[model samples]
Target: MESPGRYRYRPANTLYAASHDWFSPYLSRPVRELLDAGPHARSLLRSPRNVDVCILFTDIRGFTDLSRTIGSDRLFRTVDACIGRQIRIIEHYDGYVDNFTGDGLMAVFEGPDMTDSACRCALEVVSRALPAVRYGEAALAPIGAGLHRGDVAMGTLGCESRLTHTAIGDTVNRAARLTGFARGRDVVISERIRRGLSAETAARFAPVQADRRRTDIDAIAPIYRSRCG
Candidate 1:
């Protein structure tokens, strides 16, 4: 107990320093175990397994004007509420809300059931957002959503200050660009995603892009769906 110039690690008492300084006896057992694992803590704590399928993005429609009327403080509150609610909706359907890009939300659905789950979450979140509009709760402008399905690499990225947890690949960006092209209350579906959905789900959308090529008008065919029940 009086040794000097030396250190000891007792798995039950002293955690190894290689654990990123995160391990401490003060932490709960589960938490301590997580920390002891160091860099791989993220995987041990990960909520869902990765799936390569599709991403959905939705943006508020008339946000600029609403922001002008409400001013930044109130506008920020409204934006937070909208994004927060959407996140809950995404998680409830077993999907993850990947990122919040300003006035829009980007989410991913993974696993064998990713397609149906992603579509349902997208549809329901859009439906739920409508009520917030009536109360002017979000000061929301309008909502345009898009869904696209394809092979995409999904994982964690970066170290420290630049750390980002999201999916990468053209399908991700294409979903964003596709969402950007929708008008008020419209959900745009890419051809590939349209095929993945059920006939009932597929019936809800019209062709937006026969090909992903960018046209001057962006020539996305329109799709309309009633509020999901």
Candidate 2:
């Protein structure tokens, strides 16, 4: 059996003055307050609203091969650790995690500075998490992130008993596809993301090489790549 500390996950932020809520790590403060704001907010939750948000997708590089070598149990623990750390970073930028996709996770950011905050968070994840999670040569993989900013249909979906609140649309789909091109501490961005950034923030990224560009994403806008540098 694993030790009590082995799987014990504590979030960086406390939900209240005395006790920490287990769901705190999963929902951002705005989202929680919106839900708790009473009956007047029901329509916002029940109806699909079109909103602009920055979508970020992050994956562990070479995770499949690492899992093959380290086995599933260890990989599970590693993923848990990495994601726990990232959730703090995401929340710091006012973003909420959408879901975890095996070795990766999808996060969403909104509000005025969403694009810039998402970019900074992605950079920090690659730079900060790599050194923290590293163990020997094959223990952990570097993080890669892809970001896109656009309109998405945000709403709840499912039966009354089981429902999921999420953002869906081409913007979210493009973000996931852009992540496929990221590798080893790299942050990839769609053209829309780059355009949304402040000039100073945009300076950190460069257009992806022609050979690296995907026709589909380019049809929307070109892609850019940035390292922690």
Candidate 3:
């Protein structure tokens, strides 16, 4: 017969340890704040904070066809390298990476100089990251980017067990939509972003007629493109 003392139970440290491990990966200040709020997290979702931010989105041009031609191992290595370099440059210019989008990424720059910072980051991606990335015999495909500035709702959204801190609103959608109009090595910006730029920065871009007849965004707002030498 087994004695009762032989089956002594340990405290619930395992459960606590598992939870810590799960949340530890997302230890950024913003994510930590959401996790610390506990029950208040629900209220935060209902009334998300509003902030003026410059949203930047970038994607590799013709990535679909390119992926089909390249081996998966080589393809992923090239993509990872390209994205890592781009992200480093973005963070260097004080921008925050929001999320990765398959062959692309979304990021944001806030504060009074958000527009200028975002523009500089985009230019750097064109001149630096794009040129450095390569596959076997092919140079990395050109990147298409878009930038727009507007107020967006930022907060945690998801079920209690798994929450994600993200920004959402028309501004985000518009920025994403604008990226579709961008072609190889093109950096397009909304009129609002252009207005926020300093004189010299504004002079770097030229107004371009974007074919928005198929898209849902406002076609009246002029789009501008910048080229890197």
- What's the lDDT for residue 106 in model 2? 91
Query: For model 1, how does the per-residue alpha-carbon lDDT over 1-229 read when each residue is reduced to its tens digit?
Result: 3212111112323333344465442332233444344465566434333446678999988877777777677777777778878888887877666677798878877667778778878877777864563334434766778888876765456777765545778788778877766777777776667667788776666543344465622455443333332
Clashes of 3: 0
| Predicted candidate 2 versus true structure: per-residue lDDT over 118-161, tens digit per residue | 99888888777656664456568788898999999987788878
Per-residue CA lDDT of model 3 for 82-170, tens digit only, reads 98898899989878678789999999887767899899899788667776677668667789898999999987677868866788999
Count of clashing residue pairs in every prediction? 4, 0, 0
lDDT of the structure predicted as candidate 2: 0.76
Which should have the higher lDDT, number 1 or number 2?
2
Off by over 4 Å in 2: 1-20, 23-31, 39-43, 135-137, 210-216
Better of 1 and 2 by TM-score: 2
The reply for model 3, stretches above 4 Å from the true place, is 1-29, 32-47
Arranged by TM-score, best first: 3, 2, 1
Clashing pairs in 1: 61-142, 62-141, 62-142, 208-221
Using lDDT, rank the candidates from best to worst: 3, 2, 1
